[model samples]
Target: MTSFNTIIIQNIVESLNVGLMVISHEGKIIFLNKAAGAILDLDCEQHLGFGWGELFITDEKSNAQFNQVILDVISQQKVGLKHIASYTLKDSTCPKKLSITSSYLTEDDATLGMVFLFEDITEIFNAEEREKKILSRNAALQKERIEGLDSLSQAVAHQVLNPVTVIGGMANIISRKLPEGDPLIHDVQVISEEALKLEGLVAAVHSYCDIPKPIPVVVSAKALFEEANKSANEILDRIGECIEMKLDCTVDKITVGKKLFHTAIVELLLNASNFTMEKITDVSVKVSRSENIITIKIADHGMGIEKHLLPHVLDPFFSTKAKGVGMGLSRVKKIVFEHQGTLQIESPGSGKGTTVTIELPCPDLSCCSKKNSD
Candidate 1:
């Protein structure tokens, strides 16, 4: 009965879908089950006593992460479990994803070898990758459609501007010539004011359509922010509003188009100023860097957007304000996209305030040095 039970256990182990292998402390393969041989495409009987390096390493390369798990189990008595690794086969261009778990093989507290349990997770990994690619492609297509619309709108605005300007000028002239008590004067004044507003909108649309490709230059981030703040202050002064912006920046330098970057900041600052219901709005600007990303966050104590409207903020001609043309954020979005950056707006709810975060890619510092030398 004991012999029959042992045979049953062996059969169960051999038939497991999970691949299993055991290697000695000296890095020699001691056991390779049928599942392991099939997963690794190796003959278990032929590689029983072969070294790990001889069987796995090819062209001085191997699944270093997967092998390290087993090595740690053998050398340091460390157990690694459920670690995923990318493994490229000997002649295959595509890599396979492997889910590996490793533990010690011991008998009566004496360490004999290491046991590795692993399974192919290529299909699962590929599925996740496909989903990511689909999301990315969808975003790209949406951007293309928006940009195409922008191009068409700009052309229409350009064509309408000449006639609008003539209409506005003629109305203004008629208003100036008419008697003060004339009833037609009021009508002409309304026409003139509306035409001027339309002209301004057309100019804005034209500018948005004609944003030049950025010429990136390495500049001090602080300096750029300071310049943008000064410009924003000037605009605020013109509009009879005063703001005190608090800046906290950790990143020293960044590569960006000066005019384009400044425009992006100024647009956000103006938007923040406009939305705040308070007489004096507190705007906080924080710039930080992590790895290869430069993050700039502008937060404002303002009338925050509704939850449903957050996604449409970047859409052209979408606005929450009564008189807003809704082109500011869309223009900023275009600038951010041209710089290969991402923008996110977050707000808890109405009256809670808003935070706009922009992340730009930062290349290596060495590249900056190279460009400076050149």
Candidate 2:
């Protein structure tokens, strides 16, 4: 009956999908199933007494982590389980992800060493990594295409505007020479005005194409905020009944591209001015620094953005305003990304206010100081 029981146990162990190995208390392999021997690329008869660690190749880091697992299970005299761990083989070119479990082998009276069960997850990990690479590549390609389209649009605007400028100039000269109250004079003046409007449209397109250029200059945050407010004050004055400006900044020198920062801030202010419903009474700009990041938050007390539409606000040519071409926020996002920063927008649904936050990596002061000294 004992021999029959042994045969049944062996058959059950051999039928398991997982590879199984039993090691003796002295770190010698006492028994390994056929699947275990095949997975480890070993001959069961030849490696019966070999140490498991000596037969497999593992990096120092992975080896230490694996040894800790064994020690923990033995210390508690409990079953141990771990998943998605790499195991290196001497002849295999790549590491394999293995789910491993260790438990004590107990007889009627005494406890032997541990038995280890392993499942290979190499294919699973490889498939996940491949998916990630494909997604990353697709995102990069999309960004490149957007950039190329922006450049082409800018070039077309520039080419069309030069000839338009010449025609507008010639019309103005011809209009001045015409007699007062002449119908032709009025017609020429109207043509010049329309041409100028077209020029403004072309200029807007060029602004959308203007990618941020890297300009590492030291400038105080307070001073930059003041400059941006001063630049936008004239426009705010023109829309006096609809918009208000408030600035609150406290940080010192930060390294950034001045023109790009100014452009982004101005765009935000204009966008706020265009959307406010409750007289646009408060457009606030606040700047603060924490750790290694500089954060700028712009909030507007206006008709808040719709939750459904908020996500698309930064996409090119997606705008809620009547006159907006939808490139302003997209340009803001691109500039922020080029500066190795992030831009985030928040709104408490429709009828509430909207807030946009920009965070950029702060320059290392020590490195800047060393460069200046040199």
What's the CA RMSD for each of the models?
7.5, 9.4
Per-residue lDDT value at 244 in model 2: 60
Backbone steric clashes in candidate 2, count: 0
Q: TM-score of every model?
A: 0.71, 0.58
Give the top-scoring candidate (TM-score). 1
Off by over 4 Å in 1: 1-35, 50-119, 176-180, 320-322, 365-374
Tell me how candidate 2 scores on lDDT: 0.78
lDDT of 1: 0.85
Model 2, 28-73: lDDT tens digits are 8899888787666678789999986665535565545556656566
What is the C-alpha local distance difference test score of each model? 0.85, 0.78
Residue 133, model 2: Cα distance from true site in angstroms: 1.3
Error of 1 at 181 (Å): 2.5
Model 2, residue 334: displacement in angstroms? 2.2
